[model samples]
Target: MAQATPAKPFLLPAAIAATLVLCGLIAWMIESRAVILREGTEIVLQSEPIDPRDLLRGRYVVLGYPSQRIGGPLLDPLRAEIGEGETIDDATVYVTLRQGPDGYHEPVAVSLAEPDEGLFIRARATRVAHDMTWLFLDFGIGRFYTNEHRAPELERRMREGALTEIVVAVAPDGTAQIKALRQAGETIITEPLY
Candidate 1:
């Protein structure tokens, strides 16, 4: 009987090592999804979707804050709210919100008459996910989210009695992100006025 040539010894061990690496990778990936990031609050801002060509992260969903919701521009709120001799200059006006119908914060912009007269919520300016310097609230992927516009309404909402909540999250680059003036303490029933 002819002796069979000995099979190469490297094949079996290589196969086993490859299998272990693949299995380890699969297990880690499955476990990682269970982790939650950003121990913080959620704020639902009126956002209109946008897609703009940028230097990076091409064609993404951008949310536009509802700047003009209830009041029309023709009815200058400044004229109605402020007295004579108040300069309509670019002032860092803080909005105070009052609970509107159905218990939503309706923002009323206040002219800070005296220095340090109002309560200001804390917020941070961050670089958007390894792209531009534009800052936004980092909600979990595929969940409720908002942009810089959220800040104004949130401040206004608080002015309308909607209290802002602090949110912190880790970005893709491991940077801690934060948002301020987000209505987090109260449970908001997101609904249309009509």
Candidate 2:
């Protein structure tokens, strides 16, 4: 009887193709964020430390910005488009910020359309309240990373009401990235795009 040889499967080729696709996707994501950090328009926004009870025990600082909660007449224009029973529900929103005499950025308007001029950051509205007066949105720029040992001191300073703000770079397409963390008008940590 002749010995039979098993045919080779094509799994190897398929895996290689899949890996290439995955690498391409990862590269695209990295480059997109890098562009925002490297060449995007830079703006400064004020933030305060919140709930040190949790931050002191963690490795990162939880900073809250006034611009985060945009309400009142500011929601009027965007609210007009929302229909009955409609919720913001993770919707991408554009928030326009203008530089103040204090040199800090403040939200002037919110819209579904991307603004052609001025600085704007793209945010995802996580939840829309029933009255639509206020919505919890994620700017993707939260959660500044820090060393475990440094977390305590940073959290303490912020808790003690130290003046700290974040520098953000906003891309033309509305994407924004955190560029640096500033305290007392000085940069403490400069984040890398990559």
Candidate 3:
């Protein structure tokens, strides 16, 4: 059998260029997120407990919001606009939010189209079940990182029913970033946009 030819000499340079491009793209993405967090419209959202776990997230508490699940009377109005025989699962939904007197924003409506105005967030439905009666959506701002020692205290307070809120920054395009974590109206952690 004939011996296989050696790899092309230009292969190494091509590989290096590809790697550099990939790194640049990643840096740009991170910078964009930081910009949104730094200058976007700020809003506080009420949060509920998410299971605490040790993983790659590094001693953080996962958080869930009631707005993540838009159901009950909320589903009725959307059904008419969404029509029938359409799959909402894994679909991108624009959720309109209205700020309350307490400075916490609440979901007011869900739509297939992005709204022209008003405060809103773009989330993907992880699951849509029971004929649209339930929607499990993720806004990609669900985790709050902290030191190992502080996590337990926060978790304990969460267990004791202490108030926890997620301060989010929403950009004009409906992209959102978790800006800080607040417990009992006190900011415990603020994320740096790096």
Candidate 4:
């Protein structure tokens, strides 16, 4: 009978390959977030608590923004460009923001095309009023996760009217990541780039 090649040598190489792939995947995820946090523009946005409880999602705070529902002058140009009978649902929109005196960024204009200059956020139109007067957008920066021990206290403070603000790092493409969370001008929780 021919001697069978040992399985141990093959198994070792396969295990090494699997570990390398897992490490590479983990490294890629960390580097992506780190790039945004390290190189992107930072903006502060006023945040309010929406719903913080979710059994399936674990401990986190759901945030809502005043600029989420946009209307008035901001929608005028966009409406005229698209014309009547055009559907706005699921459309990509770039919302230009200007820093207010209070230091929070506020939406000034919304456009279908990305702004060539200035700080803007890219959002998807979630809903539009039947009259085409207003557009509701989802910015994808709505949740801030925290540890179980701290989640309840943060929720309580927000519910009791504590002013909350989020510091977000916005990439050139308008993708945003939550860099820090603040309550009453004090930094409560910060996200590490690593």
lDDT of 2 by residue, 52-126 (tens): 334454677777777888889998888887756677778899998899999899888988888888778899987
**lDDT by residue (tens digit), candidate 4, 1-194:** 99987667688889999999999999999898899888889999988787566688689889888888998888899998789888789999999999999989999999999999999999999999998888999888988787898888878877887857889899999988889888878998888878
Tens-place lDDT digits, model 3, residues 1-194:
89999879999999999999999999999999999999999989988876567677678878888889888777776787778867678888889999988878988888878999999999998998867778889998887788888888878777776847889999998999889888878987788887
Per-prediction TM-score: 0.29, 0.83, 0.84, 0.86
| Candidate 4: stretches off by over 4 Å | 1-22, 54-57
Clashing pairs in 2: none
What is the C-alpha local distance difference test score of candidate 2?
Answer: 0.82
Top-lDDT candidate index? 4
| Distance from true location, Cα of 182 in model 1, Å | 13
Name the candidate, 1 or 4, with the larger TM-score value. Answer: 4
Model 4, CA-based lDDT = 0.88
Worst 10 residues of 1 by lDDT: 125-134
Q: Return the candidate ranking by lDDT, descending.
A: 4, 3, 2, 1
The per-residue C-alpha lDDT of model 1 at residue 35 equals: 32
Lowest lDDT sum, 10 consecutive residues, model 4, at: 48-57
